[model samples]
Target chain A: MTFEVENVSKTFVSGDSDEEVIALKDINLTIETGEFVSFVGPSGCGKTTTLRIIEGFEKPTEGTVKDDGELVTGPSNQRGFIFQNYSLFPWLNVIDNVIFGLNINGKPEKESKKRAMEYLKTVGLEDFAERYPSELSGGMKQRVAIIRSLINDSKSLLMDETFSALDIQTKHKLQNQILKICKEQKKTIIFVTHDIDEAVYLSDRIVVFSRRPGMVKKIFEIKMDHPRDRQCQEFEDLVSEVIEMIGEVEED
Target chain B: MKKFRNEYTKETLILPIILIIIWYIVCDVFQLIPSFMFPGPTDVANSFVRLAVSGKLFKDVFDTLYKVLFGMLLASVVGITFGIILGWSKRLETLCKLVISILRPIPPIAWIPFSIIWFGIGIGPAVFIIFMGCVFPILISTIDGVHRTDPVLIEAAESFGASNSQMLTEVIVPSSLPYIVSGLKVAIGIALMCTISGEMIGSSSGIGYMILTSTSLFDTGSTVVGMLVIGIIGIIFDYIFTKIQERIFW
Candidate 1:
């Protein structure tokens, strides 16, 4: 499940006027199997656009994304996507939402339901299985969204600012939970965020981008072990370093 | 809250009771308006009881209901089917837009002459008119509902490899249920109107036919009864649909 973004560039033309807006230009990056990579940059840096290209939601103008050496063309269940607002189907209850991918793929209903319950239990949401998305709190809903993707056994997850809407305490709790789940399941995650602390906290590698018409400014390898303390001096120092890089990019 | 609701219900009855009393005074007690032209409350009541006892009122009511229900069923099936197809394909919808707009503005009653010519006098013409009246609202609302489907939800479905049909059934249809139900509510009212007018113009049976016959015979009491019965039916259908709308939204 390694992904290679080779010389990818995207240009969006305005509908009324023919003015071209370059979202990403000459982007090149390789994410290894089971790696947790975060794309961190300023707003409109095309970090999200780049992530979308890899997920096969948007096509790149110049190049292609290779998922395990197969050229990405369109959306596939093999790669799950998590949106910032937790786009769980409001009509579906928690268990139904989690099992949606499985159901659509024609898995046996009883088996899918059983497996969905197991996943919900891991997130301590088994009690909320019968409740619809509207009944759940923000954090709970996001957790359901994550479990929904996880249950599909997607080799990679393309998350676009998945936790940006949560309160601080909820965000930290989810970040910890996601870290544990991805580590245990060995699923590759390509996370997009403006939060440097979140990137440092979750990602194995943080790929920083330059402002609009974005390309890789730098890539930082976090050589920290699991359950890294945010209060630790090493964590604080790394956070500051990434912040400095982004600050310099902002000035430019 | 309970007491306030009770007071609200009581308040609603006051005006209707006052209107009935005024009508009684004008047409029955004083005998100002002739009985042949406009029946009093007592005359209408006696006419209602006579029709009910003879069973012609129930038969006419059933005939009208049958036409309305049959036509609505046809309209819903066709409307929802076409709506989903048109809603999904932008090109198809664009191509049909002009034709639909042209057809939609023509009132269902306006089609009565052609309907009578095509289907002949009886249930056929009435049903056709009802179908015509009901279909457009349903089709328009369903199309609107489809268009209003959240893009993110569609993206999520696509990402999970949901096929086009699967997307329509599982995601699109459920998301649009509220709008569809509302459209049905609108269609029901239109269907009733079409049934009455259609029956009055082209049919041999139904509440509208009874009203037409009674009025022409100068039996104003029976005519009033027919009108009141239609109003009651409309209220019942509206109440049922409102409950359905509430349930689906939740």
Candidate 2:
């Protein structure tokens, strides 16, 4: 089972006069089941736009995205989104925030609470289940935001700069934990970020994007094994290589 | 025991205490005005005791409370409903601007003539005037609050499958609560002002009517007492509203 896209493009109108802004351009990609893919690009290079299209938050002006076997429509339970800003509802306490998807999607509050606690435990935040989102640190809030999405057990996870708000140390810690969880659960994830080293580190493959009205610049398959040794020559070489590719693209 | 002091709570008390001291020193200690012209706090209290003994003060206070509470209740229900609809629906909001512009400038007291014409000189007209006074402040602030909610929240909830009704019930209303509380606080003051004003012009048994009759008879001491009664009652009701607001909001 794989998710595939063919010739997808999206354009938005800027104003009343209808000045067109192309956010994404002719894109083609595929991800094998349970694969973790990272899209690395400069700001406004359409990495987030591409993920939004795949998640059905926006419709492509051209082409189609097929998941397993069907076309993408408006957001479905099959897709889960984790925002960079950790969009946990600030007014809601942690348990209520975690169970938000369940409540909004019509799950009974009692059952949703049970599943929410289990998911929060998976993120090691069961103790914070009753605290408000504002009471959490940035890293902890991000974890809660992630678990909120994960609680639904969606078929695919769409992460838009998921760990960018975190410091390097917290980033690595959360990334490792997330990798382990996704691997154990066999969950496919498509993440967007600008960090080249991070892209090479966590992703099964990295999709490099060109600047504005972004098109797929290149796709690199990382041969590194799970629980990757960051010091390994192969991992370092891929990181340097991807960094250089991004540098050249940004300069152009 | 060692927690930091709340500077804000202390600041709120400074103005009231300063005003009280100034009022006392000017009227009582300094003797700037004659006792009959500017009675001291003791004189006001004596008048209160005299009126209470006669049992007329209670009836006047009760009549004022009944009118203000009933009118304010009507305003709260209608104001919140319209405010939510205006805030939530773009087309409705656009349409409302013209109507709001027309209705907002006319003061509730200014509508006294029309209210009297429509409902006559009684509690009905008096209550209608209070409702008119309170509704705009509540509605405008509530709409402002609803419009200020983060758009990202709406998008996130929509992504998670919140329907329009669920979004309004769960997201929009709760988010606008602080503004609504502040609005209601302002509305309470306006409600008190309108109820007294309506009674002065139209009603037969309120503190405002008592103030009118005392002034007509030139009982300056009783007139001072009537004014004091209205001011003290206004403060009490405002204090109660603030307590309710704090309980509901945070």
Candidate 3:
């Protein structure tokens, strides 16, 4: 359940002319078992690059990613990634979309449908099992995505700004649902986000990244309890503290 | 933008109507090309009525339709199968590029002499030409469709443990549906045109043949009537395809 990333770096050679753009620097971080971690930084700060490397979508230039003491080389069912983009099959309905992953695992059609329905109901989308993903709202789509990843029964989730498209109210609602699911399932989740409030609201720890050629500038442990209130002075102060950290890193 | 389409169509009719009036003035009013050599729209309409009464025209119409339909069906199956394979495997596609480039430039009409030599002077030769004309457009579009499928979508599938079969069936095909359908529409039109041309050049039946025969007999009105039918049928088929695209993909 614990995850470790050591000295990970990436440099993308842009264009046919081969201009080198360093995307990630020597990034070293460790995530504890069952802990919820969030990576927050400016756009194009290589936060996505780091998460991708951990999930084995892309190889790190200089380091190895270890998940629960095993060297991670490529994607495994042990870790689920829910992307920021909808990425739903427009041709498939809601439950079918959720069951899509399970069916790929060689689960029987009937059994996968049953399991999919169970997860759909968990996300409170039981009525929309037959409706296509294109018909779902942005927030509802995110819920489907979360359930889709959860259907694999993975113990860890690698979420890359999964709620970035939802409006404020929808984002809040889905975040609450994610928190609840994580709490009940005891799943360790590493979430990536640029929003200050979201990182504070969902994370057990927040790792701030500096600009281009990103490296971890600071890692803050949120000492506050679950269901943390945004109205609370401590929560607001912590949010401002993280905001200041982000601004200071950007200027530097 | 959508709200103004009806009004836009209505306004656009003015230019076409004026052009028709000018055409009428130049032909019917001016007595162009002497009466026997060039008939007006009225003569063409009369020829259409005469052909419809005798019922000989139906067979020609049926022949052309059957050839085009059969050819298009065959072309679609062959083209789509090859297209999927080519798009899915880059190495195989690269190897076949030399063959495809060499074969694509040969016009369907150019195949008529060979088609007759191979399949003989009947429906078989005509359909071959039609299929050849239609197949390339379809294959090209399918390759494009597969290429257009987002790499992110493929990566998402890969992450989920989707097998090669599953990825092809679930991710690649469904995502490429829009492009495939568009290509089919284009191919169908080309198939019909090639069918008409093939019939005119070789066969003794079909709408295109009717025009060829009328021209040889110097029946200008009948020739014009055959040309009109072919044109109308082409328009109708195109219209049907356009409607289906809007209805399904809307």
Which candidate tops TM-score? 1
**TM-score of each model's B chain?**
0.96, 0.83, 0.89
- lDDT digits (tens) for residues A114-148 of candidate 1: 99999888778999999988789888898899889
lDDT winner, 1 or 2 = 1
What is the alpha-carbon interface RMSD for each candidate? 1.2, 2.4, 1.9
lDDT, candidate 1, B8-43, per-residue tens:
377798999999999999999999999998999999
Q: What's the DockQ of model 1?
A: 0.70
Looking at candidate 2, what is the lDDT of residue B24?
80
> Candidate 3 regions off by >4 Å?
A108-136, B1-36, B40-43
For model 3, residues B112-221, the per-residue Cα lDDT tens digits are 99888999778988899998998888888888889988777777777787778989999998877777888888888888778878998778788888887887777777
On residues A1-252, what C-alpha lDDT tens digit does candidate 2 reach at each position?
A: 668989999898998878998888899998888899999977888998899888888899999999888998776767888888847777789999888888888889999999888878876789998888766899899988888888877778889999988888878888887798789888999999988788888999899999878989999998788888889899889989998888888999
TM-score to native of every candidate shown? 0.96, 0.88, 0.87
Candidate 2 C-alpha lDDT tens digits along B1-250: 0222223487898998897688788887887877656666666677778889999889888998899899999999989889999998889989889988899878999988888899987798889999999999989998998998777677667667677898898788987887887788898889888988899888787888888887676555667777877788777866776665654443
Q: Of 2 and 3, which scores higher on lDDT?
A: 3
Look at candidate 1 and tell me the lDDT of residue B51.
98
Q: What's the true lDDT of residue A40 in model 2?
A: 92
Clash-forming residue pairs, model 2: none
Lowest summed lDDT window (length 10), candidate 1 chain B? B1-10
Query: For the second chain of model 2, what is the TM-score against the true structure's chain B?
Result: 0.83
